[model samples]
Target: MFAARRFSLYERAFGPVVTPITSIRGLLQDFTTTAAYDAAQRSRSNDDYFATIHHISNIVRRDIYMERTLNKMCISKIVNSELVYRVLRSCSRSGIESFRFFNWARTHHPHYDPTTLEFEELLKTLARTGHWETMWKVAHQMKVQNLPISSSIVSFIIEHYGKKDLVDQAVELFNRLKSFNCPQTTEVYNSLLFALCEVKNFQGAYALIRRMLRKGAVPDKKTYSILVNGWCSAGKMREAQEFLEEMSRKGFNPPVRGRDLLIDGLLNAGYLESAKGLVRKMTKEGFVPDVSTFNSLAEAICKSGEIDFCIDLFRDVCKLGLCPDVDTYKIIITAASKVGRIDDAFQILHRSIEEGLRPFPSLYAPILKALCRKGMFDDAFSFFSDMKLKGHPPNRPAYTMLIRMCTRGGRFVEAANYLVEMTELNLLPLSRNFDLVCDGLKNCGKHDLAKRIEQLEISLRGD
Candidate 1:
């Protein structure tokens, strides 16, 4: 009778000796797959994915009673490695967050071993986000595992360090090529050199180039150009020019723009004649300056209060069969306006039109403002009238300057007229500008003009 009662109690408590293990496994699989898919779909942005992961992690921690035992939590027993990888990929855009999640995966889900590809993906995310220290740790872990690191991965790390101005770290990484078992390539040397040059470490950079040559890596145009640019930036114009000549001797054509950069450096250092001589020499050497480079020189010259020199430069450039671009025309006209040479500015406008170049609104605005500042209202208005005749009415900036100048000069009636023109052109002045004109009119004892300006402003708002 005792045995019978024991059997009956066993039946009541355990039901059967066989457990539904397959069913439980299936449920866990479904839960993980559904959770991953739902989380990925819900993540519209990096921040969104981060929040989703945070929420899911909280639930897992609470459900697992992981408060005091997080490091020992067996999340993989419920979630699976496939689901973890998918989650990692989905949150890839948020590199830092992805890294945190990766750590959580490794610590909380000890059974879920990451594959080589998984580690690579994480490394990529870290590299892109400039997480170098973590990247190094991950790389070291891979190294400990005897996994092969790719050339592209090394290049990326070098380039990342270079761009961040971490010259020493970049150099250190490059030097570890043999340890990483990655062969050196010209591309890798270029990246290392670029980083060194970016920080103005020309001596160290040249040393690296020598090492590269010893390693059978040929220096390319980019390598030389970077060195030239570095010297120019460091105010070593003579050294930069010497490197350019050396680059040419090596049969790698140095970019014409490098000469332009040197010219700018010379001009800025107050070597006016030297700058001009460089420009002429570059052209004489068959290194023709492009339109953009020519404009840069002209603008720099104008800013240096050498407007006459700029005009002469413009004439010289025209003689070379290189027509002036819109920027070139703009600078010349601006220089002309700066010295109260309104007629010369007008002549440039006419020349640009004859050459079929349509000046931008920006080009016209400054000239108009300069004219108004010099009390040349008639000339400014005449220029505006000519622009209208050519189907290019004055834009908002031009109108604003004209109205502000007229009001400040105590011409309230003229300000009101300008406001009316703006309304007719469907251009509304800012409320502050309107207020300026209104206050000026009222102060000048023109109550009727001020009221009209207020009505015009109200109409602009469709009130």
Candidate 2:
């Protein structure tokens, strides 16, 4: 009797178990057909999600009674928090409309509760549209909800105000942070400092830094960089140096070395010689500069038409225990290629690989370009093939570049082959490239090949 009762209970809970498909064909179809159906369903669901948002945006934009119309459509039942946020983003430029949609979601949608994501997104949207009064109202609402605004938002607003030359407003915002229940952090201070620097209010900017220290908020790398950069931009290197020294005396070394900060400042200020001299002194004394700091200097020097000098500097820094990054190799390789030093470019490329860096098109394309420039077509082809063989295949831009180089050299057959190969790899060959190859082939009396190229374009485009 207990066994019968147990079986009855199981049947009530799970119902009778459907018999599993026993045939091989049925089992295969269960996996293969069901999986494909599921994938298709997901694709359709994604399409519907975007379509729904677009439809809502259109209504919000055109209909005066958009909220009522959405309600009558039973949007409250279907709408979710994520859907509401997406719709807000879609109509973001329409600040009033975006706010209405957000408000509608909160009040009307059955289960749609606004989160911090929606709140911050609305704040940012309102701020972007210069809806200052409305933005404050939203902030007040956030405080009511116990959600204090983020420091990032403060920084963005300050930067915006600085861009519009509203320095006073930026300051007002900084001073008003306490009322918003936001703590005055380094980022908040940096924004104000940046605003001061924008207006060349160096005196005020410097004072702000001292104020930061007094408030027990330590200035970070960005703080030092900003002040130093501002001073450097104004050609007041002496004052910048004095400020650094004074800060050092106060037991506040920057997160990065002060010297690196100075170099970066000098570089931004267009005082390349001062930066170069400072770097030389550091490296000469066996002090390794930050790779990024050195890279900035190296990049700047290369642009000044002294790539060879930059290369020497790269080697000197490497010897002093400074490992180079991908960007470092990219800079030297590009410079070498531009000056027709293919051999040196090749050596740099290999060196970067040996240092455990993968090759990118920008890194190797220059060498191919240099080879092509010097009529070393075979070498360029060999290099490209070798790259593919070693698992670092060129991307679309690189393929387009190679095809263009081939066409330029009257190698239409090779160009046509590459065009096919690119398509085989699922890269869309531009229609213009197809026309160029077809025309070239026709002009060379290779009509058969030209027809094939034309047919391939038509097929790929599904026209």
Candidate 3:
């Protein structure tokens, strides 16, 4: 009977059961994937496009041997330039996988070459990930194909090199742009100037500016703005102000971003009086600085022990009919909380909500945390409940804070309930919270409850 059974199994191995279960599973997956492919092709939503690209790239990265199969299954029929561009954009986080897919598409497929924007995205991915060897290979591919190297690409390369303090490398790239057939435009000049200033090479940047002038490249407002920003960030307020004045005299207004950078720099350098004066000047000159700029000044004032002045300034700005953004409210709320004026914080919260501003979780966290630390559990829980009622529930940090507070106060049951809620919400409580809860429960002689909670925590973690 055993011999007859072995012979039957051997015959089946050469028949319908020849293919393994794994192979069958793969076939089923391929069938499902075809449906996904059809859906992806018909998708018009940006989120769907990104998710599709991410999904395809993930498959390619899953197994070295599966890339060809995945490409044949999904990417082979893709001929849309817009779709390809979106795929390249989605590859920003996975440089190697992106490079592999790009190479496979370009070499094996032969129907799709990298577009200019695709190449740009690839270079950006390469730059962000420090994949210099592959970057060089991609650049060589561009060169071989006689692709027109863009000035923006040149600037991108130079800016990245400058960030790494590789000034010589950036300079070499600038000098070699002619070899790449990229024209040295005024924008390119400004980019190089910005790179020099980024490395604090003001002397080198000034020389480059002179060279640009000699080359008949007129410096634009961006050029002066970069210089002003560089100097301001370096704490050379005098130089920054001089450049700002120079820009104005040359019939160029420093952009709002530049103005904000200058304000932040001044406030950070303890030049509060100077920063306030600049804001006043800006308002007088018909340049109403944004709320964020004003927030920076207010925060600096609060940090300098002038919380009252900061609050007054916030109110005065609102009276000017300029809507205070979430950032502005956060700054004032934080300042009030720091001064133990929880009532003031809540008052501002109500006023902001009454003014039709949506309160995000970020706006609630600091207030909840501050109240919890002050032993004002009633007020903290009140705000937490209000957050949920307003359809903006407290997130991980808020819950963690409450859990820790409860456990420390020997409220083990409350802490465990919060922990359970965190697990249900898929928010992992901090390790310290677990420790505190376990120890608090044991100290209360709830040994069985403690054990059960420990097992629940383990199960939640899939251990």
Candidate 4:
């Protein structure tokens, strides 16, 4: 988020409000703002400031009775919201300790006062550790301080409660949002639905959706996805379709089709077989699954070691107007390489590039591994060089893999050349790498190259 800046009197004036940046007044204000920004950046980088937060966190983490210890330290200045938030996050796992530290920061630390950010973070930390009572206490404090608990925070809390299976508490929070002056927006409703679905309370989730409809709040895509996912997880696909049809009948059409929602949900709930069956059926009908859902299905199927079936699905879907994304290519390429299908992997890589996607090291590293596995050293080296010169330069892991393979293949001179190449790229080969190349060179009777590798390590280490 952009930080808030202090407005100057001249800049705040009505005359300059309409003035362009070319004006003298505007230029002066810009310089002043820039200088303040620089000073703020320097303050943020100060080690002492961070060390202070760390020190306070250590004390808070040890015991919940932080006020007395923090008081004795006699902190000389007021802490801002960000500092307070950082310390609270540091003590987040210990809910009681975080609350105690927060109380001290707001009430005893000089002229400090907690803002919405500090209050929200404290509540989130408390919720994270299942401190239900203390979380409400903080919410009440926020309300009493005339701070409205934003709907976004309410949604987060509800989502956390759902993950913990505390559906009742989640419902309670949603019901009491009016007390906190937070409206029951779509976000809050969706969060409650998620919590209900987490507990397999789809009936309750459906009721909540009804309430949202009654309140005239439009159901967004996430709302539809959540309910559909719940039904699919419960093995109630028939009910899921009926629900979508009902929504459509009510003139509440989801942004996507019902088929995509069901397929994605099946994939998420670990029903790979069911998802695959639906995908095959859909493609058979010339109906395209959503690209995101297709990519997810492909990734999941590839992991099951049925790469051929997944590749067939990829082709079938693409023919049916499903455009594969980069993730789709990555999954296919990786699985192809894993199965020693280097030619297939190369074909997928080229297709990704033909689709105008930038080729990256990850997209080709597996091919290098496959080549090395097959002892095709020349092919691996050529591909690595092409990737560096024509595509994105290979990253450290790629270089390391190539180096290790070279040593094992008795290509000591080539390995030494790569060690030098790494230095040119400002990528440090690992200590183990230097040992591998040097040992291989010594055994192969290339002492001059071995000495060069050793010197390279020494120069880089500045020893």
Best by TM-score: 4
TM-scores, all models, native as reference: 0.62, 0.82, 0.62, 0.87
lDDT of 2: 0.84
Write candidate 4's Cα lDDT for 54-170 as tens digits.
998899999555677888886746377888888988888988888877877766665777789889989889988989899989988887899878888899999999999989888
> Scored by Cα lDDT, where does model 1 land?
0.71
Q: What are the per-model numbers of colliding residue pairs?
A: 0, 0, 0, 0
Better lDDT candidate (1, 2): 2
- Report the alpha-carbon TM-score of model 2 versus the true structure: 0.82
Most lDDT-accurate candidate: 2
Expressed as tens digits, the lDDT of each residue in 1-463 for candidate 1 is 4223323432332223223555567656876877776776666566664564565555343444433343454445544555556666665555666666667777766677777776777787788788878888888889898888887767777777878888888888888899888888877888888788778888888788668767777776567656665676677878887766765676645445567656655654566667778888876765656686677678777887989878866776677777787888888988887887767777787888889988667677767877788877767667777777888877888788888887777766666667767766778888988899899978989787577667666645644
Off by over 4 Å in 4: 1-45, 63-75
Model 4 lDDT, full chain set: 0.83
Question: What are the per-residue Cα lDDT tens digits for candidate 2 across 415-435?
Answer: 787787787688998888998
Clashing residue pairs in candidate 1, if any? none
Model 3: lDDT of residue 411:
68
Q: Clash number for model 3? A: 0
lDDT of 3 by residue, 366-398 (tens): 787678778776676667777888798768887
Ranking by TM-score: 4, 2, 3, 1
Minimal lDDT window, size 10, model 3: 9-18
